[model samples]
Structure formats: structure tokens, C-alpha cells
Target: MTCPRCDAATIAFSIPAALRAHLPDDRPGAALCTHCLTVTPLDDPPDDTPSFERVSDAFPANDEAAVAFACVLALLDSLVLYRAELDAVATYAETHGADVLRALERLDADDGVDAHFDVARRTRQLEQFI
Candidate 1:
């Protein structure tokens, strides 16, 4: 995997058995990029780097995007499956569709780009209602 911070190639580091046992998914350990001194858990992406060390802003903040998606989800919770509700969903899809597509494109283009907010998955969730 590439380093999320510097976009450098990453080297895997060995983790003690004690730490590996505690980690979920039977994951091995963490990786480190000597160039940037970034240490990320084996499962976590390099884009999970500290905000201060972030290399780019092409991807939306996960927290902010999650909140936005949650709000849309909340709105969905109360929506009745009717034409008006469907229209509202359609309007939302129309408004955000392009942005979502572009984000997905960026994600596809770069492994360093993190989906911190799981934007693609959440967008799909919203789209299903449309």
C-alpha cells in the first residue's frame, strides 16, 4: 500500500504476537513509511494519517461527510414511500450525483485517497431510495 501522507510506497513492519492477538480480523500488524514516519495499522489506510500531516484535500473529510450522510439518513427515516418523497430523493440525487461520481473517480485513481467517510457506500444507500 502507498503511504497516505506522502504517497510513498510503504513497507510492512512486524507486530508482536501480543498486539496482533488483540487486533480484529486476524490482521498482521502495521506498516511504516520511513520517509514520512507515518505508522498506520495494517487494516487502516495511510489516508488515516493525522490531519496536520494530510497531503491533499481532494477527498472530503470523513466526519463531515458522515454527518451529512447521517442527516440524509435521518430524513429518510421519516420519509413515506410516496411520489413526493421519491421526488425529494430524486432532487437530492440530482444535486449530489455529480459530486459523488467525481469522488468515486478520485478514489479509483489514487490508492492514497481514503474513503474516510465511506462516501461511495453512503451515496449508494441514498441512491437506493431514489
Candidate 2:
């Protein structure tokens, strides 16, 4: 599956073992991290959803389906919060980074000047990469 993040296509599939404990014993499946260990599936696959779809065969990224899902994820954050997330994304964008997902992790830091400092340094580091 195309990692819904950086779009680096890969066939690696399966959820992390830590989370598999929560999965139903009936089905044989896994949802491993294609990126970082940040976000969660939030729910099982829809009833009719197929196991895999070829990205190469799908519409271009400009299509409504792709943009809508992505935009919705982005709009879930405040502008400030969004930037903080982006700063994290920008950090990972350089080397082995998972930009979109990790960007939000910075928001989890304790509130105060220390948080701002961490954000700033990370922002600069991300900027260098971009």
C-alpha cells in the first residue's frame, strides 16, 4: 500500500505486534507502521474495503478522493498546531522522516517556553532539510 504519508510505495504490511493484541482473533491481519509509531488506525477496515489497491492504477494525486482525505487530516489542527506538526514533518522529511504523522507529536510536549524552544530548533532543522 502507498504509505498515506510520504507516498513512498511499499508492500510491507501488518500492524505492530503491540497493537495486534487489540485486534480480533478471527481475522488474520496486521497494520504495522509504514512510518513512525505515532498515529493509530482508530478503527477496523470498512466492511466492503478491499485488502489492497494499486496506487499506480489509481487516479493522480490531484483527484478529489486523495486530496479530500489528506486535507481533512490537515484541517483537524489549528494553524499554530498545524505548524508545530509541520515542523516535526519537516524534521523527518530530511533523512528517515515520517513528515505528516510525526509533525503532530510536537504538540504533545509540555506547555511553556521549553516547548517553544524545542519547536523552534525542530523547525530550523526541518527547514534545512526542505
Candidate 3:
């Protein structure tokens, strides 16, 4: 899976035993973005949906999809600092919509006046690796 924010490759990681009790039992693992250091909860893939088929369904031609794609690109350019491909952002926005994109923007925002400390910390780690 890719990082929802940066479209970077993600590594599957098991939730620590201590934290498992606080989460839903159905959550099997989490994915950590290599580039952005964002952690995402993961669930089992649905049985009926083939992954390849889902990939093919990502791009649906419609006005709403076009708007979402444009909005996501604007958000990435103005608000987000992480590197992301245009096609990947379009695909994600098409599938998830504007609300999810807004949430990601809020999570990654690092404005000097109202900094997000956790996001800044994670971003620092990414910078060090680069």
C-alpha cells in the first residue's frame, strides 16, 4: 500500500502488544510511510474485491472526480510539504474525496505561526534520511 499523504511506499508493521488492547481486534496491522513517517491503521482486504480490479477502477471519468483531483493538487502545492506525484494524488482524491484530503492537509500542516509539533518531528526524521 502507499502512503495516503505522500504516495510513498509503506511498510507493514505489527502494532505493539501494549497498544493492541486499545484498538479494535479486527485491525491486523499498520502501515508506516517510508517518506513521511505517517502511520496508517490497516484492515484485511475484502474477499470479493480483487486488488488488480480495484486499481483499474480508480480512475472514473466524471466532473466530481476532476474537481477532487484539482483540489488535491492545489492542496498539495499550497499546504503540504511532502513530495507526491500528481497521478497518485488524483487517484487518491478520486477514491477518497475532499474530506480525506483536508484531513491529510491538517495532519501535515507546518505553518510557522501554528506548527504541528508531531508532524514536524516526523518530517525531521524524513529529512535526516534524505
Query: TM-score, each model?
Result: 0.27, 0.22, 0.32
lDDT of 1 by residue, 36-77 (tens): 434455754333333311423333455333212212322332
| Backbone clashes, each candidate | 0, 8, 0
User: Model 1, 37: alpha-carbon shift in Å?
Assistant: 0.9
After superposing candidate 1 on the true structure, give the runs of residues whose Cα lies further than 4 Å from its correct spot. Answer: 21-26, 43-130
Arranged by lDDT with the best first, the candidates are: 1, 3, 2
Task: Mark the 10 consecutive residues where model 3 has the least summed lDDT.
Answer: 49-58
As for candidate 2, its clashing pairs are: 14-30, 14-31, 14-32, 15-30, 15-31, 15-32, 85-103, 92-97
Cα lDDT tens digits for candidate 3, 1-130: 9978778765554433333333334264555444554446667433322221121222223434433332232323223343333334444444644333333344455232121135445334433322
Ten residues in a row with the worst lDDT in model 1?
66-75
Candidate 3 regions off by >4 Å? 22-26, 45-130
Q: For model 1, what is the C-alpha lDDT against the true structure? A: 0.40
In candidate 2, what are the lDDT values of residues 3-119, reduced to their tens digit? Answer: 344444323222323323332332323222222211224234333322222222121232223222222133233334455544433333323323433332333232311221243
